[model samples]
Structures are given as C-alpha cells and as structure tokens.
Target: MVEAAQQPKRRKRIAMVHPKFPPSFWSFGFIKEIGGFKTVMPPLGLATLAALTPDEYDVVIVDENVEDIDFEINADLIVLSSMAIQEERMFEVADEFRRRGYFVCMGGPICNVLPGRCRPHCDVLFEGEGEYTWKQFLTEWEKGEHADNYVQEEKVDLRDTPPPRIDLLQTSAYRVGCIQTTRGCPFNCEFCDIIVTYGRKVRAKPIENVIKELQAWADAGVDFVTIADDNLVGDRVYAKKMLKAVGDWNRARRYPLAFYVEMSVDAARDVEFLELIRHANVVETFLGIESPRSEQLKETKKFQNAATPLLDAVKIIQSYGVVIAAGMIVGFDNDDVGIFEDQYTFLQMAGIPIAMLGILQAIPRTPLYERIEKAGRLRSAAQGNNTLSVTNIEPLKMTYEELVTGYRNLFVRSYTLDAIGERWLNNVKQWGSKRDVPPFPGKKPEDPNPADEPNRKWIQKPLGRPRIHLIFATLLILKYYFAGGKEKRNFALKMMWGTLKLQPAAFMQTMNYLAYFIHLREYAEKVVARDEKFNYVFDDKNLTAESLGEDGHINMVKNERSKKTKINVNDAYDGAEVTADIAADLEAVQAR
Candidate 1:
C-alpha cells in the first residue's frame, strides 16, 4: 500500500476524464431535471481509479456528463474510462489530449473488449480490474519504465480494495450516490460478457468494510445510494449476513439511507431474503428476465429464469415491498413473430411499471457471439444500446425487418401514457400493500453493547427547502391531473391518494418514474421512426454462408425507402424548457 505522506522526487499532475454517454432509456435526464441534479449517478469506477492513484500525484476528476472539461490545465498525463457507446467521443478526447503532448492512458470494459481499436491512441492501457495493475503501472512509471499495455492475469481479492475517493466528486451534482458490494455473477448467460470480464466466481467485500463505507456516506449526508453490483445476492449466505448487518446498522441510525440494486430473478424465490432486503430499506431492484418463452431462455442458457413461471416469481418478490424494474429482450434465435406480443402481454400481466425492452445484441467474446460467429449469422459490432430497435445478428426464425418492427411496436405500446399510468398504479398499489416484517424475528430491538455513535446525523428532511426540480415535477403532475382527459386525471388522482395513504416516500418515487417516462417515451418514438425508414429483405429458404462477410458481419443493402428523420428531444413533455439544454448537449455529442 502507498502511504499518504510519501512524496516522489518529481510531482505529477493527472487529469481523469469520464467520456460522454449517449442518450438512451436510462439517461434519466428528465428525472435529473426534476430532481435538481446533473446526472443519474457519478462515475464510481473513475472515482475508484482516482483513489488507487499514488498519493504523491495530484489528480483531478472530470465527468463530461456533469461539466465541461478544462483543457487549459497543464497535466503530465490524461486517463480515460468509458463504455462502448462512448467510443467515438472517447477517441476524440484521447486525440485532443495527445495533440497537447499529454501521455494518454485508457482502460475499462471497452478497452478490454476492443484493445486493438484503443491501443493506437494511448501511451499505456490497463485492461482488467485495476486494483493491482494500476499500482504496478504507477511504480513502473515512477522508475521511467512504462509498457504500452498492462493486463491483470489474476483477479484481485475484494478484501484488499480501498474505499472509493468520494471526496473528489461534487456530491450535489448527482441524484444518488453509488457503491459496489460484489464483483461477478455465477450464471453463464450466453450473451453476457460479465463472466468473461470478472470470472464466474462471486467476490464480495467483508461486511465490516461495507458498513464502514456506508458510515462514510452517511457522514457525508448521502441519503440515497445505488449498489452497482451485477448480482447483489448471488451467494445467498453472504447476502443474508450482509443484509442483517446493514439492517442493524440502519435501524440504529433511524434508517436514513435507501438503496437500489440489480440481481437475478432467482432472488424472488427466497421469501426470507426478500424480507431482509426490505428491512435493509432497499427501495427497488432490477431483474434480467430476458424472455418469457422457455425455449428462448434455454437457447440463451438463462436457466434461472427458465426454471420458474415468470409472472408468479415477480408477484412473489413484490409481495415483500420492493419495486421491480424488469429487463426484456427480443430477437433471440428461438423467437418468432409472436414473441413481441408475448413480451408486451407478460409485462402488462405482471404489472411491471418499468420494463426495459430491447433487441438482443451479441457482445464480442461472449458465448452467444462465438456461437453466432461460427454459424455465419453475425451482422455487426454491438453499438452498446440494445434498446435501439436494432440487432447485430441475423435471426434464425425471423427476418431482421420483422424483428425490428416488433421491437419498435413493443417499445411504443409499452411506454404510452395510458399503458404506463395503468402499470404504475398497479405496481405502487402492490408495493404499498406489502407488510414490512423484521428480518430477524424474536430479536430484541435494543443493541446489547452499543458502540460510540459517529458524530454525524443521517436523515435530512426532504420537504424543508423545496428544490426547483421538485417544484417543476409538482406542476407537471398537477397539470396532468387537471388538464388531461378523464382517464389520465383519474389515474393521477388515484396514484397520489394511494401513495399518501400507504407510503409517503413512494409519492416522490412515482413522480420520478413519471419523469423517466417522459424521456423513454420520446426516445422510443424516435427509434420507431428511424426503423420505418430502413428498407431490407431476407430469404430464409435460400440462406447461405456466402451472405456473411469474412469478419462475421452480414451484408444488407438499403433501398430507396431509406430517408433520415431528424429527432427533436423536447417533444415529450409540456414544460421541458428546463431540460432542453441537456438534450441539445447530447445531440451535439451524437453529431461528433
């Protein structure tokens, strides 16, 4: 470990930049506008990298989504981390920094998958988890010896990881804080690249370390947090112990923090686990129920989802007071024309208010990518936005046109005002009705041997000083209540009434959902319009290996029907001027 007081012979200045992200379903700019924040969440990975840097180096972190980068600051090195969707902008940023004679270093998931494309722009590239590789790079650099690439052949144990440098962030810029509890998933879904990146063995931090981090956040006055785990409860025993510790920690402080997480659908089967999460004050979770058809699940090797009836499992989880945001994908090899309707009906029947519908894309090096590549059905590299009504692989049972059309229709129908309102009402009602049970029954409420309380308070009154965004959200909801048609007006009233009667916290959460719908509905419409302009055809009966290119991409030609349509980002809401600049900024990045 590097000591904080150590000083190198030569002091170095480093600038860490997080590249811009594209507009997508989860951009949540609309919600950010109403919630008085700039981004949905801070780039925790970049923050962690900043913490890993040697203490002698002066580091400054900049996230382009929150603020513009200052090019005037002189720095010895520039470091970047990004996803695949931000590849173009990332390259542009790297070129700009390299032009100014700064040594550029790049790493993250994108670099791991596409190192060949990323190598030319960087002086050094750190590929796998950086807990160990980063330290090695710093040591070598200080001695004037640096390599073009440093990849970790072995995964680092989670126990040795340090707390992320949250002090580097402008805390008020994001709506919620982020923390990662676990590293990998045990399941082998064909299209998933998680195991390829982090291995199949689940690695987690010790419970004491987790609590110490949470206590740090609590001291910093962070009220809402998002756990950025691939699967929070992949190992049931570890999860139970962690949740029990968290529950005890929260109860002692009067429960100030609320959390959100991502987990597999199998969590629904564990009623005891559900109650534990509820007691820990987890407000929501996202589950990857990729498809409703058993055959499709089998083809993708998502056996956990295939083993159970989908709707029953959803209801079972909601019965314990946690809202579910489901992920649905179409265009699998086994999906036919009817799969679209099946997906829509399943979400409606299951009362999932927030369903992320997408066409499947085979990421590079995953089992699905290898299978499709060998079958000569690959089309192109994934654009990293799976919900964009486009697929990168040729389907076996359906044409590309059929798949795009079905995906477009599903997105449009699912996010309509009436459709979303109905689902939200049902979900809020179900969540409100669930009884809050103690995770540890028959245990005394008092702590037997109380330790000294941290010299900080956790809870902050939300209604004390109303933010501008909250006021805007209120006006919009009221406008829909009074000016909308009878059905919308009635639905709005019932939502407010139910939330007030059951859980007051849910009213704000529901408002946030409505804000999200404003963005997603508009994006869906744009995708549908974009799809309508594409002209293509496929012949299933006469398909041949010659149709695919040497690089495993399919060759398709567009007809005269192809015409680009300009998309307006401000068409979804009535009072959208507050967030108009956000849309303009994203459009400018997209153009670059």
Candidate 2:
C-alpha cells in the first residue's frame, strides 16, 4: 500500500466512553443540580458510534455518566460503550486507556456479551450492533487495516442508520436528544435480552426518518427527544404510521421536539395511537409493568403483559396526557414471600411516579440463559461475569438471602417518605387535565446551552391539589439534610425554614421529590446491596467448580438443589392487584 500511503497519517484521535452509575445507578441524582428538572440521557449509542465515524476520524465524546471523561483529552483512540451495569466501569476504562498508550475500542451490551472477556483490556472489540460495526471500523481505519478484534457487524439495517452525530454531542451534558423509532421486542421476556439483542423482528425508522430526526432536534436547540424505543409500538401498522407521521410531523413543525417512549401496556389499545402520542408532545412513558401477576405473568414468558390490566393499562395510558414510567421486578419463578407487599401495594395504588424496581438479573444469551442452563437453574459462580452486581440466575423460589432480603424490602417499601408523598400526590392528581397547556406547544423555550444555565431552578407550574403542609416541607428538609447528622441538621433546618417560611407548593413538591428520593435512597442502600444471590441449595457435591469467582459460574451452577423451598405467604392483603381498562381507575392504582 505504497508504504501505507506515504507513511505518516496516524492522527485519528477518538474518545467516546460514557459510564458512571454510582449514586445507586442514578435512581435519581445524576448531579448537575439533580439532572436539572430531569431528562438527561444523551449518549445515543455512543453518539451513534460517533456518527459512523470516519470524517478522517477525530471524535471526542466522554460522558462518564453525564460528564467528566476528559482524561486530559488527548487521544489516538479510546471508544467505549457499556451496560452490564457498565462492566466495572468498562474494565476501568479499558485499563486506563491501555496504560495511556491509548488504543482501547470496546462496544456495548457489555461488549455484546463478552468479547472474549474484553480481550485482556481491549485494543478493539466492537461486537454486535454499532450500525455496521461503526462503518466497518471506519472502513478498516481508512485502509491502514487496523485490527485486534471486531467480530460483529450485526446492524440489522435499522433503516440504514446515520443521523446520530447529534452534532457530536457534549451539547451541554444533555437535557434530551436520543432517537429510535423502534427495533426489537416481540415478547419472549424470559428475563429479556431484548430478544437476544434486538431481534424478534420489529425494526423501524421511517416516517421521513422520524421527521428528519424531529427537524434535527428542532435545529439542535433540542427541547426533548427520547423515543429510544425498545418498542414504540413495534409495528402496529408501523406504529400507527409512525404516530400519524409524528402527528403530521408535529403539525408541520409547529410542535417542536418533545417525546419519550418505550411501550407495551398494549399502548392502551391505540386510542388513535394514544391521540397521536398526545398530539406529538409525548410527555412521558416507560411502561413494562412486569408483573401485576397472572401467575407472575406465566412465569416470565410475559405473554404480552398477560393481555393487559396493569392498573387498567396505566389508567388508559394516563388518560392520554402521557406520563407513566414503570417497570417492576424482584426475582421471579412464581414469586411469593408476599412479593414485596405485592409490589408495594402495586406502586402505592398505581399512580406510578416512576417505578423501575429491580433485582431479577440473569443476562447472557437469554431465554433466561437457556432456561436457567436447562433447569439446573444456573449460578455455578455466575459464568462469564457480566456484572450488574453479579446475578447469574437460579431462584425458583427464594433464599439468595430471601431474595436479597426481598430486594431490600422492595426498596424499603418503594422509596418511603410516605411512598414519595403518595406518588407525588397521585401524579399530581392523575396528570391533572393532562398538564393543561391548551396552547404553548409551539417552541418558545429553545434555550440549548444557555451559557451552561446560570443559577437554574424552575418547577412551579402545578397550581392545584398541593397542600398537606406543602407536602411535608421539601420532604422534611431532605429527610434532615440527606440523613447525616448535627442533630439532624438542626432539626432539618428548623423544619426546612418552616416549610420555606410557610408552604412554597409544599416546598416545591418537596424539592421535586427530593431530587428523586436522593437517588432512590442511595440506590436502595448501595448498588442494590451488591446484587447476586442464588442458593437454591441443591448441593454441588463438595463444592469448588474452582469455587467460581468471576461472578457465580451460572448462579453457582444453578444452586445444586440440596432442598431449598420456603416460599409461602398467604393474604398479605389478599392477593392485592387492581386494574380496570382506561383513564383513571384511580390513576391505575396510582401508577403501580
């Protein structure tokens, strides 16, 4: 190759990274002043793998979970992308960018489930799904032919992917911008791997490629964008012709960006595609509703959420004003020990302020890892360690210390402070006439990076049904200034200055549910108390499958069954579960 094209073109840079969950996997507090009124997310698949890289390759993205990855910025190639609760900080950022000689390159879904255990600190591992292995590793690194490992180009042609360089991000550490109209999830749910990583046939990205990505995120001033779909109605006539072509492309651009997606609560039987995603503003949605229990939804095959009743399909999709966010789970296999007070009284009677309950992890070529390694139930030292605090399956009934002490008493009774002031007063009274806004959707707040927002603080707007001493005065001064002491911070600063000197809308909805319950009570007491716990107790005769280290070689070889049963709770409150089919059956039991 003519001395590889006259010998001197190695200036390729790249950085990309993006991990950092501690704050208990961001249950709420992702800093920057509690994720500035929420909607952070931007790492859109490593900024769409740095926009299929190769503009003579320079890239720099670094989101160490929202900001601070500039390990002195200089780079020749680092590229990351995590998730397996971010493989121990992506193997300590690929061994500190390969001891700073720099040449890392890994990929996500925990390097597509173990790229040879990140080939001894990766020099390249781009496993599956990175829009054609990032343009064939940037056309084999502009033909110098770079390589160490790149075995997966699993694109599945998401409508010929592109458009995500989102102007090479950094755009003020995100407030919103993440797009995907759809891709995989037809429902097999055996502890999901999203159909073994985006399969079960359901891909989409048309409707003018999602209105030219909502007119390039309303010309990059982005108001909001997350349709990062696991299911934005997986093909219901192309999700109602892409929600009536995003409600006629935001009624011909008069509706500037604002959406959030993830579906299946049978998308409330498409009331005109939930009123065209509520006239394309799409306030919020996360759904999943894991188990309202139909025999734990046919023991996790999740038969399309057992033909819906998840609190009457989340109060008929929050009676079309949107906002619902839920996803619950805590060990499965016919769950009993009063399934954490029936999922904390079904998310405190389903007003679902934001559930995402966790714990039943297994992941790794799912079908619940080949039927819990063919019913041995798995865990012999959790084979091929894919860290999410090490859960490698096996719990057909209980004892992984009573399913991690009933997943820390289902997050100490679903984040109590009176269950976040009764699910923020039943989602501010069932989305109170859908956050009213009879007009304002045309785009006035186009403030992109307002000089990194000087002294920001907004949230007032609620205007009704808020009183109970301004809802416990900013959650009793953040439960006494984040529960440390100095006489409980002078009795929580004299009752949070006597409720901001007398009820400032319950001291701003208890300082917005105290920044999401101080990150869900420190991720329910530290990274879900380091997760993994299987022990079904079937004796692995004289133990030592090399006493399995890397994280329980398949739930300690499926807990060797020496006789572990113990699950017998009867009438914790009489098989409690509620549902009716639409628009406020008490707001789907207050979004449980």
Candidate 3:
C-alpha cells in the first residue's frame, strides 16, 4: 500500500465519470428513440458509488452517453467506473485527468481484471466490490493516509448497501432506471467472469431495502426499472420474498412499474415462482441459452442450463406472459460446422425472436482464459462485444476464419427481414395464448373479468398507451407493409391486427421488438462488412503491411510485396512507406 501525504482537511469536489459505450446490439438506441430518451439506461454503478460518498463531499456525475464531460470543471478528485468495452476510453479519460494534476481513482470490472493496463493512468486503483472499500478509502483519504491501491478482501453484505443517489441522475435522459436486488450467480460457467469478480455465493439485499429503492424510483415518477442482477432467482426463497414485496408495492401505485431482469432457465421449473414473477410485472427476462447443444453445455460447465430442455424452458417462461430475450454463442469446443445451422434452427423452433448470437470469447480471469492460455491458443484480450465476429482464443475444431465467417453468416440469416418477422409472429402467438394467472388479489385491467360483461368501448381504449410509442408502431407497420413483399406485408398486417385485437397491452412490447430488429438488421450488416475488411489481419498465412502508395492512400499489403514499400526513411520496412514521425517511433522501438 502506497499511502498519500497528510494535507489540510476540507470538503472535496468529486467528479465521477461513466465512460461512453460503443454502439452494439445491447445499446438499444432505437428503443430509446421510440421511447423518448437519449440512452437506453443511466449509469447505475456511478450513481451507487455517488451514494456511497460522504455527504461532506460535493459530487457531480458525468455519463458520457447522455451528456458531454466538462473537462474544465474544478474538482479535487476524479473517479471512473467502466466495463471491458469502455477500457480504451477510460484509460484516455484517466490520463487526461492525471495530466491536469487531478487525483484520479478507478474501479469497476475492467480495472479489476486489467489493473496493469489502468494503474499507470490512475493515482488510486480499487479492485473488487467497493461497498465497504470505498468508505474505507474515503476515511483514509480524510486522514491523508489513502493507499494507492485499495483492494477489497471480503465480499460486501448486500443488506448494508445503500440506496443509490438517483437524484444525481438526469432521469429523463434514460429510457429505464436501474436497481440491483442481488449480486453473483450460482453456476460456474468456464467462460463467465461474474464468479471471479462477485464470487459464486449469491448475496441479496433485504426485501425492504429493494422496495425502498423502487419506492424512490416511483416517487421520482420513473416507471421502467431494470433489476440489474445477474440472476435474481439465484436464491429461490429470497426471490419469492422480493417479488411479492415488489408486486405489493407496484399494486399500491396508480402507475405500476414494469421490470426487466436477467435470470437462469431453471426459474421456469417452479410454477408458483413463475406466477409471482408475472404478478411483479416483469416485462422481459434475458436468459443465457448459450447453446442448444447439450454437449457444449457440459463442456462449458453450464450444467444448470442443461437441467431442462432449453426450448421447453423458454416456452414455460413465455407462457407466463414474459418476453424471452435469449443469448446464443457459437465457436464452442463441442461445436462443429453444423453448429451454425443447429443454432439457427433451434432459435426458430424455440420462438426466441430477439436472439443475441456471438462467437465465444475467452474473457480474462475466467477458467476458459486459463485453459486457452495453457493450451497456447490465447490470441488477444476480449474486445468485450460478444456479438462481433471476433474472439481472443484460437478455437479447437475450427480455424479463426471459419468461426468469423460462420458467426457473421449466422447474424445475417438470424436477423434478416423474413426471419425476424416469422420469429416475432410465432413468439406473439405463443405469448398471447399463455394463461398468466394474476398472483395478486386484484385482476390486471388487461385481464378479462368474468363478473362483468366485456364492453367494446373499454376494449377499444388501449391500456397504458403512450402516444409516441403508438405513432412509432404505426410508422413501423407502414414500413413493413410498403417496403416488403406479399409475405412480409401479410405478416405485418397480421401482427398489427393481432396485437390490437388479442393483446392490446402487449402493443408496446411488440413495437420494442420491431425497434430492436430495425437496429439489429443494420448493425448485423455492419458487422459483416467490418469482418470482411479485417479478415486479412487475422489470416495466419498472410503477411500484412501498411504501405503508403504514391496516390497517398494507405494500402494494406497481404502475402505479395509491393514495389512502393521502399522509402527514404531508414526505419521503413523494405517495401513500406513511413512518415518522419512514424520512422522515429519505429527507430525508438528498435533501440528498446
């Protein structure tokens, strides 16, 4: 531990920055556009950290996704939290702060896993859960005895976790507010780093504490809340208690809050639990159906997923009126050439329209990374965007090129106009037919009442209708009708008719899916184009070089040598061109 020197005691101005995320399938910007928000979600981690800060400290949060970072702001210390995708920008921001003589501290998953990469840029580094360590650091800082590195040796008690200072957020900027009820997952998937970071033992906040946080959001008039847990039902007993509390809390309010969560497939096994989740008004659940192939599940040690048939489990959940957004991965050791077709077929068969497909990545600190490193198959650090046609490890059965091509092909086939429409229709049909019993005392307004006769006027009025969402839905339906062929036009017409007729309450959900498809279709094409352009870089047989042609264009040479490679600079390669600055940098590298 490197301690800081004693200084005069005073109130500190802390600027916490949540780094910008690169646009990906998860960004969900289209949903934000339709839903009337700038970003898909706000920075919950930063908000929680701000809540942990002492009241004496003047704190300001800057989420780069929502607003510009004011570099000129006067601050005694700067703090940053980020994931792997934002690592490059985090380092850049940290270095900028350091250059300005600001005491910068960094934490979160990226800094924890790749400390060496972040250490040079930050004055203080925090590794692991900061619920306790952050307070300790602040105490030490006030005493002028803060350490350069503060790593938490013990897991945090979730009961002690404070409600996030959500007041610091610009609520209108985000489509959804976030609240975490639990931490860690029970399963030990070889490729997962959640256990490495948060540990395998599930720790949940008290039901009252969770409800208190939700009440804060409710008081703030935020309707959509994402329960940002790895698996909310990791402890079934605790989950039931939490769900019941949330359901009761939601029922008391005029505008009930809708929730979205991530959970394992095993949650579907318990019929009573499913009813509770439905009553809680959870709109969607992201399930990690990593692969349909059972062999791959066993090989990866994701045995919990294989406990039940994957398709049947998905159907069971959808049967409870919950939208299932699943994750699927290719390039597993047990996967072969046929895995692509198998995955595509399985998704369609399962009726999971919003399938996030990706090539398997060996994240650092995970068992998969260790195994791959031991096998000398590790190529590079994970890029963090799993949907990209890239991986850090050399696959076992397939070459790098094969994996990239196959993964890209899967995206194209899976997200095409026809495929998405077909899957959406199937999903809606299944969802509409589900007999979701309201676990609460009062029936949902959307649920048909047996005691009262159904009136046409009551049915015509859309339940919980947002005018903007309706407008977007109408436009999307028109786009589908005019732009598509007979089959697509018919599908669009059917969807529009079915949603309004059978499940008017689910109209928003239907629009959300269409919005996602619109973004995904475009993004998938971009991924394909990106892969084609960079495929040569990953080609082992090809020798690549950057050469400046006489036309002043940067030419990427592969396999064959170019005559224009020779230049006046001594540091230049035999057949490559180099500017004076680049030549000097190359000469310096040679000297080292």
Which one wins on TM-score?
A: 3
Question: Model 3 over residues 1-592: C-alpha lDDT tens digits?
Answer: 8799888767779999998877678886544554456777778888899998989999999998899887777898899998877776787888887887888999998876777777887989999988888999989887999999988878899877899999999877777778998998889999998999888899999888898898887667677789999988888889988887787677666324778899999887887788777657776789998987777888999888866656567767876767788999998987766677667666765568788998888877789989988999877656567776667778878777666666766777887776776566556555543442222122245434311212211111111225566576557646755586786566566666767665565554565566566667767765443542333221123322212233322112221122323222342212223334434533443332
Q: Per TM-score, what order, best first?
A: 3, 1, 2
State TM-scores per candidate: 0.82, 0.31, 0.82
lDDT of 2 by residue, 179-256 (tens): 887778777778777767777788787678778877887677665677878887877788877876776676566555
**Ten contiguous residues minimizing lDDT sum, candidate 2:** 553-562
Steric clash pairs (candidate 1): none
Query: What is the lDDT of every predicted structure here?
Result: 0.71, 0.60, 0.71
lDDT, residue 472, candidate 3: 68
Which residue runs does candidate 3 get wrong by more than 4 Å?
A: 1-10, 30-32, 436-491, 498-505, 531-592
Residue 35 error for model 2, in Å? 30
Candidate 1 — which residues are off by over 4 angstroms? 1-10, 436-469, 476-491, 497-506, 527-592
Model 3 TM-score relative to the real fold: 0.82
**Alpha-carbon shift of residue 57 in model 2 (angstroms):** 11
Q: Which ten residues in a row have the lowest lDDT in candidate 1?
A: 450-459
